[model samples]
Target: QQQVKQSPQSLIVQKGGISIINCAYENTAFDYFPWYQQFPGKGPALLIAIRPDVSEKKEGRFTISFNKSAKQFSLHIMDSQPGDSATYFCAATKGYSGAGSYQLTFGKGTKLSVIP
Candidate 1:
């Protein structure tokens, strides 16, 4: 299965608190891990990503912790802010999918709310 399912669907956290969302997949062929952040109706934007080769990857207040054997990954937002309130999605692809017929498959989606 190429499907990646995300959990919680929605979350509410106070500002400056940590926000976490999780995802799991059944596909073992996937090699790339990506997390996206969306504000609204627009498309999701790449937030942080890791590869099966790496255990964890982080950028600024965002982080992606991955486990290849477990076929699981998660996104962590540190000191989350109200601006961070949006939708987050976890995605998986066969590494670069080489841009032709195949594209990244995304999770259903998870909306997060950061209260001030």
Candidate 2:
């Protein structure tokens, strides 16, 4: 089952414009939300994140707004540039499992392209 769904599988944005990607999840047990950014031939790195208790979190030009009741979250990139072009994945953690490991679920991913 695809617990997490992301919209706009791909996006094209102009330089200095804002890029927005949205994601929704079906599992309420998820407590931690993290967004990862990946470039070509590179591993995905943590971008920004928010917990269920917080509605929003921001770092630099990247921001994450979360809605606990709606089970949705979003990533907003301000002043998008060509360097920001890559694949972004929104993920959620379901705390610790019986196996003593955390269960993480990721969205399909969104491809972003920024043109000057």
Candidate 3:
């Protein structure tokens, strides 16, 4: 089963506009929510993250708002730019297990395009 689900397989935004992506998960054990941004020929880099303890987190132009009760989270990109065009992924982790390992479940991914 897909633990994490993302919407809008693709998105298009005008320069300086806001770009939003949403995701949902079914596992209540998930405690960590992270968003990753990836460009062509590059690995996914952590953009921002939030724990169930917090409702939101912001870093520069990027922000992550989480709703623990709804099991949902979203990424908001303020002043979207062409350089921000890439694939964004939402992920969830339950933290370390007794075996000394953790598993992360990622959404299908959303491809974002910012036009000039």
Candidate 4:
């Protein structure tokens, strides 16, 4: 299990703009970082992720930036759209399968609103 810290209780972005979310973890044991997007009445779905060794990772319009020394990471959503509006959560885990505990601790989500 890993503890996570996230910010921006909420956000509002214009259509075609960029959406940003940030998270941090103090536990060096955490090796995997992932962001999840959730819609109303639906389970959170994996959006993007990055490893501590990777400085940055991008997929489509989503990007993840990781800073190992600072134990911090952030998510950037480019070309924001109305469909992209949702609650975003940042999570961290140790990626241990042979352990007694395997869980992902998430932070208070950032509610992003993209204006049309």
Which candidate should be chosen as best, given lDDT against the real structure?
Answer: 3
Best by TM-score: 3
Candidate 3 per-residue C-alpha lDDT over 5-55 given as tens digits, one digit per residue, 9 for 90 to 100: 999899999999999999999999888888999999999998898988989
Each candidate's clash count: 0, 0, 0, 0
lDDT measured at residue 67 in model 3 versus the true structure, 0 to 100: 90
lDDT score, candidate 2, position 10: 100
Q: Residue by residue across 1-116, what tens digits does model 1's lDDT show?
A: 54899998999999999999999998888878889889988888988888888898889999888988889999999999999999999988885656544578999899999999
| Count of backbone collisions within predicted model 1 | 0
Q: What's each prediction's TM-score?
A: 0.92, 0.94, 0.94, 0.92
Estimate the TM-score for candidate 4: 0.92
lDDT comparison, 2 vs 3, better candidate: 3
Which is superior by TM-score, 2 or 4? Answer: 2
Q: Which has the higher TM-score value, candidate number 1 or candidate number 3?
A: 3
Could you tell me the TM-score of candidate 1? 0.92
Q: List the residue pairs that clash in candidate 2.
A: none
The digit string of per-residue lDDT tens for model 2 on 1-116 reads 99999987999999999999999999888878889999999999999888888899999999999988888999999999999999999998876333325767999999999999
Candidate 2 regions off by >4 Å?
Answer: 96-100
Q: Candidate 3: give the clashing pairs.
A: none
Worst 10 residues of 2 by lDDT: 95-104
For candidate 3, give the lDDT: 0.92
